[model samples]
Target: MNKKLIIGMILGAILGIFCILGARLRLPDHASFSYLLSFWYNRVILGVIIGLLPSLKSLKLSLLRGLLVGVFVSFAFYSATGFLDLMGFFAGFVYGVIIEFVLFKLNQMEKL
Candidate 1:
């Protein structure tokens, strides 16, 4: 597996864990086990997408790529829930940038 893929997957899973907790805490009544699982998996997919997407020369462009992919991937679940989980949805955007930032840093380090 590519290092970026591994990194993204690991990061995604880590972020997913947090998402599960946040969902549980925020929507205690509505957050079912299956729902949480789906949420986690969705984040993992986001990581996969982030890992697979081509990197750009500009840091800003790369981060924007992450943001767009994050929003696109996250929108599926967001709409599925009828847009009830705003935090979860928005978290996707943040997580996307985080994943990209980590990968970008790694790339920079590699060039040194």
Candidate 2:
């Protein structure tokens, strides 16, 4: 198993949990899905994306993969609740781009 992927997943989940907790602290009476936003959106999905960073060897690949996942997830959400999940799409897109950049830069630094 890929250690980096495992660690990334663990860290992402933890981060998402913290985000949910913080939001709850601020708004105890938050909406239903609001609580799961961080976990489902940022942690699980984002973790899976980041964990696949190795095979997503290029920025283009990352963007393509991300866009596909984003659109699919958004579609699922929309179909389930008849609500267009703009935030989910946007967040997934941004996560894909950002992770690509981070990984690219890390590779560059390693080569230097």
Candidate 3:
């Protein structure tokens, strides 16, 4: 894998672990699994940022491509966490799509 992708994966995993740990510590003892999963969901934003960093040098990929890559990265990282399952994977994918859409809009505005 390219350095950028490797870096993205490492960063995503670190952030995901930290997020999960924080949630477990701060939430009430009776917190639902879904409530804890919410913390993992937020890590998708970090995945999105990592996705955008490598692409800043060239906007050659279409927005769809960027979103796909972002989702893939997020899923891969989330898979490392024993607590996350399929639902968390899907949520991360959706978060990636939203992040890519926002980034696309911002990039367009910057060019104008």
Candidate 4:
């Protein structure tokens, strides 16, 4: 993998784990590992955002591209949020699609 992708993955994982640990400490008795996993897993939006960093130059849009980005993001999130592995995967995938669509619209507007 390229340096940017590797870095993004590492950063994403670190952020995910940090968030989980922070949440656990703050919530204490209320925090369940499963719930924390689900919460962080849903944060795929963060990954989608990370994926868009490189595309800011070209701003191209494609489902495949989105999925690839989502996969990497999911990987990072999963690696960080070790509580639930695949939980973040699905959430991240859907979140990536949504964010990509939003970014596409925004980019189109910027052209006008």
What TM-score would every model get versus the actual structure? 0.94, 0.52, 0.45, 0.47
Specify the highest-lDDT model's number. Answer: 1
Pick the TM-score winner. Answer: 1
- Each model's C-alpha lDDT? 0.89, 0.53, 0.53, 0.54
Candidate 4 lDDT: 0.54
How well is each residue in 2-98 modelled by candidate 2, as lDDT tens digits?
6545644554565556545654555566435754673355555565556665644566776676556545544554455445344544555554445
After superposition of all CA atoms, the RMSD between model 4 and the true structure is 8.0
Q: Tens digit of lDDT per residue, candidate 4, span 47-108?
A: 43554464453445544455667776667656755545454466456555555555545545
Predicted structure 2: lDDT:
0.53
What C-alpha RMSD separates each model from the true structure? 1.5, 4.7, 7.8, 8.0
lDDT of each residue in 1-112, candidate 1, tens digit only: 8888888888899999999999999999999989999999999999988887766678998898889888999999999988999999999999999999888888788731
Candidate 3, position 64, lDDT: 55
| Ranked candidates, highest TM-score first | 1, 2, 4, 3
| Residue 112's lDDT in candidate 1 | 11
Question: What total of clashing residue pairs does each candidate reach?
Answer: 0, 0, 0, 0
Q: Any runs in candidate 4 off by more than 4 Å, and if so which?
A: 1-61, 83-85
Which has the better TM-score: candidate 3, or candidate 4? Answer: 4
Where does the lowest 10-residue lDDT sum fall in candidate 1? 103-112
What TM-score does model 1 achieve against the real structure? 0.94
Show where candidate 2 strays beyond 4 Å. Answer: 14-30, 33-42, 53-56, 104-112
